[model samples]
Target: MQTILSVSELSKTYDSRFQALKRINLDIRRGEIFALLGPNGAGKTTLISIICGIVKASEGSVRVDGHDIVADYRAARAMIGLVPQELTTDAFESVWATVSFSRGLFGKPANPAHIEKVLRDLSLWEKKDNKIITLSGGMKRRLLIAKALSHEPEILFLDEPTAGVDVNLRRDMWQLVRSLQASGVTIILTTHYIDEAEEMADRIGVISKGELILVDDKAELMRKLGKKQMTLQLQTPLPLLPPALAAYQLELASDGNELIYTFDAQGERTGIVALLEDLNDAGIVFKDLHTTQSSLEDIFVSLMKEAK
Candidate 1:
């Protein structure tokens, strides 16, 4: 796992006396899908923009594949391709022409064979000659991806890649992302879809209020912060929790017909045995019980709230 991109003490400040990014430091591993999750204006896009040379950092340094982004701009930028959230293609230009032109923008030699392969991989080969305005929204999204791959960049940035797409198209894009990773592309994903990050990212980075709050392997992050809840369906509704079960701090739900207990999933002991024993002593009976583990969305929301 080589470090392909490194950001050290990076900061961005606008002229309006607002800080968009706050001393951010991150290292993107080679060939890994890293999902950057955050709320609107959480600096996800700002960070990506800086790394892709679209925005200048007010302080600190960034190196892409050992090339300083500022001093060696061309070399650093040449290794990266960006698929912006917006669809800003030439409406009158054919798909082939737009994609071909993108490759040339990076100062790369014309490789028609590579361009054809990218189009074919994105299922845009048949529509290569079609004008951009004539394509469907889904096709246009795929064409954006094709343009990003046109330059054969080592790193690809997908900024809200599936923003307005349908479920099926989102799934297709997920598969395409996986294929790109398989082809040895380091992908930086900025997405509002938590489930997409949970499904596609090898590692997750959560940012809030211009700060990188957490970065961890997806599974590890879940297991470390995830909580579990046990819901017990009571045989009879109670007006209130018994004094004897006060230590458990359980909540009454469904108008007292249900009891809910929340605990850390990684805790050494859940205290369920003692809880049930006390419940029986209080003449409380549950007909059924079920448990649910916290999801990434739950963790993400909790993190954001805590950051606030």
Candidate 2:
């Protein structure tokens, strides 16, 4: 895969007292949905700001589409679009006027057709004539997206794009993100919603205390870190796990109604079949069996705990 954005040894410091970001390095793939996951003040916004030229790096360099963001500010910025977390826009301006004005700011010639397409794609066409102050929170977010796309940027940055959005609107936004990727636009988004990142991101990057901790393909990351649990509802309550089964490292529920087995999902052998056979040999019976895989939320919490 081609690299659309690269960050090398990037660091951010304020007043030379607080370090917001460490020496972080990342490569965002072209035309892919990359999700940046982090807690509040994890430097996600700072990193995005530096890449978009809003904040200056304390040290290191960033290149967007082979253009250095600092040395070639115009060209690098022209290839990128940013929808910030805040809903900052011309309060009195109509959606159409605001979007058109953003395009003009980028030195783009007036293209009504392109503007109309962006608005329609974001479901903002009907609200185009309405003032920003009159729009709903969700609509305002869409307008931000519209304004970002107005310039026809190759890379799009979505900072908490679906924050406070309803379920239906979130789904619509997810679909729209896919449509944008299909149109050859690279997307890098920071989101607090773990499920959203799990569902939409091709790759997941985790940041902790302003340091890039992990970056891996979504499926690969899950497989690497995901754990599976097997629960067996026993027909007969066992006060304790049999000594013979101790080597299996099984856990006994306090109620004695179930036996739980924890295993790595990436392991070649889950040992469930052997455990079942052992139970049969021991004259134990199970009424039912169930299994569950760890979710992205679980992984996120675990990572945060480790970082803390």
Candidate 3:
């Protein structure tokens, strides 16, 4: 894969002497969906702002498609489109006009066909003549995406794209993202929704307290850090865990109707066979059993804690 964007030793410090980012370095592969995950004030937005030329970096550099974001601002910015977290648009302008104006901002010629295609893809064609103010919150978000695509950018930045969106609409946006990736557009996603990252990102980058903490493939991250748990439904409820089961450190659940055992999913051995044999010896019978792997949210929370 080709490196479409690169950040090297990036840092940011406001006039208040507060640092918003610190020695951040990242490389985004062309045509790959990269998810940026972090808590509030973790510098996700700052990094994106610098890359998009909205904010200046105090030190270091960023190159978008081999053009330096600072020295070659116009060429670099031309290759990227940003859907900001805020809903900032011309309230009095119609949807069509707003999207058209955005394309013009990037020095793109008037291409009504392309504009119409983007609007239709975002399900906004019916609302093209409507004023921005007449649109709902969800519709406004869609308009932002339409504007971002109006310029036909090679790299798209979606910052909290589905925030406050309904379940159905969120899934619709997910489908749209997939189609965008299929069309060879590199996507950079920043979201509070860990599930969105888990579902959409090819690689996950976690930042915290102005630092780039970790970056890895989504599956590899979960497999290496995720835990798995097995729950057995006992044929007969017990008052509590027996003393003989102390070594397993199992937990009694469902008012003693179930027993839960947790272990690393990637461990060499889970000890399930030994535990089952011991259960048979102790006359503990289970009618059924099931297992579950830890979710991305669990791993994200633990990472935040460790960073703290």
Identify the leading candidate in terms of lDDT: 3
The positional error of residue 268 in candidate 2, measured at the CA in angstroms, is 3.5
**Candidate 3 lDDT, 156-268, residue by residue in tens:** 99999999999999999999999999999999999999999999999999999899999999989999888899999999998977789899999999999999999877888
Compared with the true structure, model 3 gives a TM-score of: 0.91
How many residue pairs in model 3 have overlapping backbones?
0
Model 2 TM-score (2 dp)? 0.97
Q: Lowest-lDDT window of 10 residues in candidate 1? A: 262-271
Runs in model 3 lying further than 4 Å from the true structure: 233-258, 266-269
Cα shift from native, residue 9, model 3 (Å): 0.9
**Range of the 10 consecutive residues with the lowest summed lDDT in candidate 3:** 262-271
Least accurate 10 contiguous residues by lDDT in model 2: 264-273
Deviation in angstroms for 256 in model 2?
A: 2.2
Ranking by TM-score: 2, 1, 3
**Residues 24-141, candidate 2, lDDT per residue (tens digit)?**
9999999999999999989999999999999989999999989999999899999989999998877899999999999998889999999999998888899889989999998999
For residues 1-308, could you state the per-residue lDDT of candidate 1 as single tens digits?
A: 89999999999998986899999999999999999999999999999999999898999899999999999999999999999988877899999999999999988999999999999999999999999999999999999999999999999999999999999999999999999999999999999999999999999999988999999999999989888999999999989988888888899999999999987767789898888888898999999999999999999999998999
Q: Flag the better candidate by TM-score, 1 or 3.
A: 1
